[model samples]
Target chain A: MRIALGAVAAVAYAVLLLAPLAVIVYSVSPGAALEIPPSGASLRWYAGLADQPRLISGLFTSLLLGAIATGAALVTGVPAALALTRGSLPGREAFLAVLLSPLSLPGLVLGLGVLTSAAVLANATGIRTAGTLLPLVAAHLLITIPWVVRSVAASLESTDPALEDQARSLGAGPFATLFLVTLPSARAGIVAGAVSAFVISFGNFALSLLLASGRTVTLPVAIYETVDRYQDPTVAAVSTLTIAAAVGAAVLTDRISGPLKTRDSSARSGQPAGPAALEPNR
Target chain B: MDRSRRRVAGLLLLPALLVVAVVAAAPIGLLFRVALYPPGPVAPLTGGPELDSFAGLLGAPYPSVALRTLRLSLLTTVLVTLLGFPVALFLSRSRGLSRRIQTLLIVSPLLMSVVVRAYGWMLILGRQGFVGETLAALSLPRVGLLHTEAAVLLALTESFLPFMILALAASLDRIDPDLLAAARGLGASSARTFFAVVVPLTLPGFVAGASFVLVGSLSAYAIPALLGGSAARTFVMEIYELVTISFDWPTAAAASIVLLLFASALLGGAALLSRRRSARTFGT
Candidate 1:
């Protein structure tokens, strides 16, 4: 009976989780519009996505934004994570909370905050400041950095602080001890955090929705525009590409972090970046 | 080691802190500032006189929108939580290839763009979509699933399920198997062991998962915007439209604040309840 129950659960998950594959099917459907029991199969839509200027540009823009934002997040977040976990700074919890608060707020509010701030800045400066790349990166950095901070912080928590102390006792300077001892030990976490940050930024839409403009559209926003106006399979083709990207990133995360193995360390702790739901009991 | 290192540590955090201040904290402050001011564009430097968006939001469709948001969120929460339980249970118990594949399946949806997933649903749930075709085959007369509360509920539940499942499964995994074995050994039936031993211990997981789902549902814009339609406007939808359509930043700011407060209150209550439970457990 329990086995049957587990099977039922697995089948149910298979159905819900496979929902995205519907896009793949629809993208290839010969029908100009969507059909669940596909009428016929063709690659017409995928062929058309290449010609869609908004989509082509949006793809490039999303990649660029994601790269810059992820770069900013890793550079800042790694150091912040090190200091927070090892530095024993004053008001540590408060600082962590403030930094990670972006993860807590729904992206609607986060993006809107960015939008509002831009409006405020424009108002103050007597300049038209809506829909700029700088705010977009900043907003992405705001949301994406938490992933970096959390993963790196979790790894930092696991690493022995005494390792750094030992290096220091060997007469290494503070900077040398950090570069030599702390950073290398958390290398896996840093790599994992960077991957997570990039993917999170790439997948992010809500923040982009508010920050992106006609010239600076991200893939999600571009897709949003396409779908809002039309129901053709071209959007589905775009979706299929994103779905492929998502799958690749997930596989990458699994491989790079060996996420399942190390999660056992912070599994109980529920590290902020982890999908704690899937962490297995040791 | 102490003074210099501590100072260096503070310096290390400064860049991230500054970005958060400019990006996260200031926008929040601006949300409040312009919300109180007039119903026009903000003047960050030249600040304007206060207006009452809170009072304004209390009137008209804003209240109705808030009500709809709450109803949709509650329904989404209930559905997502129930759906997550089986998945969480499966995840907690499964191992090897089944586990890896299921983990990928469950986690991949979250990484996909909201637009991409929403578009997937668009094709699948549309009147002529697969679900539509399936419904037709079942002899159910044309029941258009798209652009309805039910559709929104379905998609929102899907969107929020990952957060709930992840939280619940992690918590479930932490439980000692011996406790469940002991319950069963003592003649408690499987069901009894589950209810008496499993559910009680995983209350924190339930709270954590439920809160994540609830919060996501409350503020969700993408799934509902795409699947819920213009007619089934959510609170966030109203905020978006207020800015884009009504050209009212003040009202949108106000709406954002009110919605933020509403979500915070609910989350705060959940946190308080969980804390109290923890306190009780520790007190004994």
Candidate 2:
């Protein structure tokens, strides 16, 4: 029974690891058609990426959108995290629930909701928000802020409160103590949160689908379009690039947040560490 | 916390709260409002509040779509749980570099976009792809799995297995090893110890992970869009088609609300179940 279970697990793990790698391998296959055990491997499809203008532009848009959304999330989310962790706020659990509610919300529902609301606003105020980057940013913020708050809050919880108090006692004002002590100590969490926020926003598809116009198309949207229209290796090439970018982000997040995760006893106890803690509803 | 400090905290929280209220909360409210409106041919909201769209949703096609979605999600959840448990057990027992490598393998795929993953599945399941090629080599008919329910289920299970494994591993890690030793020392069999101790203890993680997979599969758009094609239309796909293709915003709004309610009910049920189980176990 144990051996059978082990065998099942090994196969499951192989499927989990190989499914994504299949795209990378297929992209490098030296043929126009997608086939396993290709005739030869080449970077021809990677070179073909330059010919796809929609995908190139979509990549840029996705990057810019991710950066802006991450920056905005950090600016708002860090302060809120500080307040939630250190402010001794009343109804803290309820407040946290409200802030993290979007994580549970289906991206389809959230996207439709944001789209309808944008339409309403456009009709009311005559300022179009649906086709622009505004609603995308807003929806991305809704999804990303929870990560920021959770990460920073977890980090802050592990630190000694007396450090901030000591700084205050040693002639540091509240703001000075916050900047020099509180924020500095939570830097790992902050960076991890920012990285996660950016990745979530960049790879987001359902929300971006509802909000993206021709001009605001993201890479995922472009890939969807390409796959819908054609069965070429270019889509595989694009997906491979996306996979590479995500792996890079995951590595960066681990490098920065590894020590903090080790220090987080609650994470060790039951909670999944890093970006896996909360489902981003990709 | 003094009043001034509390006030400062509130001030700090206002921006995020405002953004959520405007973007997240208000849009849901708008969806509800739009759903209530009478459906118009050209305009989504022509008349005052009515249930025409909701009534339409109860008729043919939509119910089947909802059922298909629920069926797919439930199947995906079960598949994920079954496959994830052993891996979670392995993860809980492993240490050091091995554990880190295993974690990276589990999580790196999650970081990639669903679209990319779905595209990968397309390659594997396509007519001239891996499965088909293997079948051809076996001198059998090449049957494309793409656009089938099985393909979607396979992809969904792959996408969500990491979540279940992580959740279960976390719970398994929290179990005291000595409890197992005590069970064995008390003359219990290994299976008996596992069934009585480990399974009950990990129930919360099981529920949490199952709910995530269930809800995620229900709301998934990319997998169904790419792999399911026209044959296995899901609830989210219905909502998307209604909004974009049919341009029936009121019906789409009604559909969105129904999906939201379904997801929330499942999550709430799981939360309640886990809480009650934990309370019973710990006597809290």
Candidate 3:
């Protein structure tokens, strides 16, 4: 009975996940206009997507933005996370909360704030920032950095701080212990955080919508405009591709973050795979 | 030199602190400053910051938006928690393929961006969507789920459910099944065992899950914007419009501050709940 129930759940899960993709693919299928069912599917829309250079450009721009934002987040977020988790900073709890506070700010509101602040600065300095790529990237960082910090912080928090202290008691210097022992222990969390940052930045739409100009339009904003202008399945195709990338990142992160330990006994044994596994990195 | 070492720690954290201070805190502070002191019809800013925006928010439309956002988030949190708790419990008990399937169902949606999920729902709930077609097949009147409060509620529930599951699953993992078995041996039925043994044990996770969904729903933007229509206006939506469309900086800042305060309160409540659960568990 449990197995049967599990099967039902799995089927429902697959349908919920794959249904939208099926709709998009079917909508663009050849002979789809035939009354009851399409006789054949075609790759016409996939081919057509290539011809739209603007969309192709948007994909490139989005990739570039995701890269930049993830880099910025790692630079700022990882160190902050390490400090908060390890260092006995004053008011650490309050500091941690404030650092992670952006998580509770809606992306639209965050985007609005970024835009308004940029505009205020630009008007003050007679410089343009409203329709620039840098500002959009900056906005993405605002949202993505929190996930990076949170993930890394979790890993850092759970780790036995005594390990570093022990390493220091031996012959190792503080920096050496940090680089070798502390960082290695937090490696899994760092990787997970980085993956999240990448996906969060990549899939972001609100910031891009408000901030992107003709030159800086990312794929999500592109899809938004395309769908508004035309009810084409091509937009769906783009969305499918983006969603696929997101799922890929998520699954990879899950695998990297280590196996699910729904049971306490299972969690103890589900240690992260090391270099030898060559498994999907979180 | 030892003093310098301590300074090095501070120095190591300077860049991040600066970024947060400039980007996050400044905007929020600026938002409050602007909101309190709405710009004049001509100059945009005349005197010091005032409470006009706060006062304005207490009036009809803004208050209604705030209430609606709260109502939707509260409903979503409740629904997601109820469904999520059972699923998490099942996951904690299962193994192998069953566990994998459960994990996939729970985490797959988290993989999708809020925008894509919104788009998926748009396809599923739109006028010519699958739900409409299915209703037609049953000869039932098709209700439009899109561009309504229901759409917003459903989308928020879908997007936020995964977080609840994650939190609940984490907490459930901490509970010892032997305790449940022990309860069962004492003649407790399944329901009684669950309530008597499992629920109290996993209460921390339940609170964590509730808070995750609550805070998540409170801050969600794409779901509300994509699924809701004019009537389903949320506070976040108001803040966005004030900044982007109207360029009313003060009012936008005011709206943001209001949101910030409300979110802080909600999160604080969640934290307190988690702490209380842990304390209760330890006390027992």
> Each model's DockQ?
0.51, 0.68, 0.31
Docking quality category of candidate 1 according to DockQ thresholds: medium
Please write out the lDDT profile of model 1 over residues B166-230, one tens digit for every residue: 77777788788888889989999988998888888789989977876777778778888988887
| TM-scores for the candidates | 0.92, 0.97, 0.85
The alpha-carbon lDDT assigned to residue B238 of candidate 3 equals 76
| Better candidate number, 1 or 2, judged by lDDT | 2
Candidate 1: tens digits of C-alpha lDDT, residues A155-212: 7887888988899898998789889899888877787788778878887887778789
How well is each residue in A234-281 modelled by candidate 3, as lDDT tens digits? 566677787677667756765775442332233653322211111111
Off by over 4 Å in 1: A35-39, A126-128, A259-264, A267-282, B40-51, B133-141, B181-189
Candidate 3 chain B, run of 10 with poorest lDDT: B38-47
- Model 2 agreement with the true structure over B161-248: per-residue lDDT tens digits: 9899988988898899899999999999989999999998899899989988888899899999899989999989988888888788
Which ten contiguous residues of candidate 2 chain B have the minimum total lDDT?
B39-48
True contacts kept of 2: 0.65
Q: Tens-digit lDDT track for model 2 on A93-132?
A: 8899889888888897898888888877788999987668
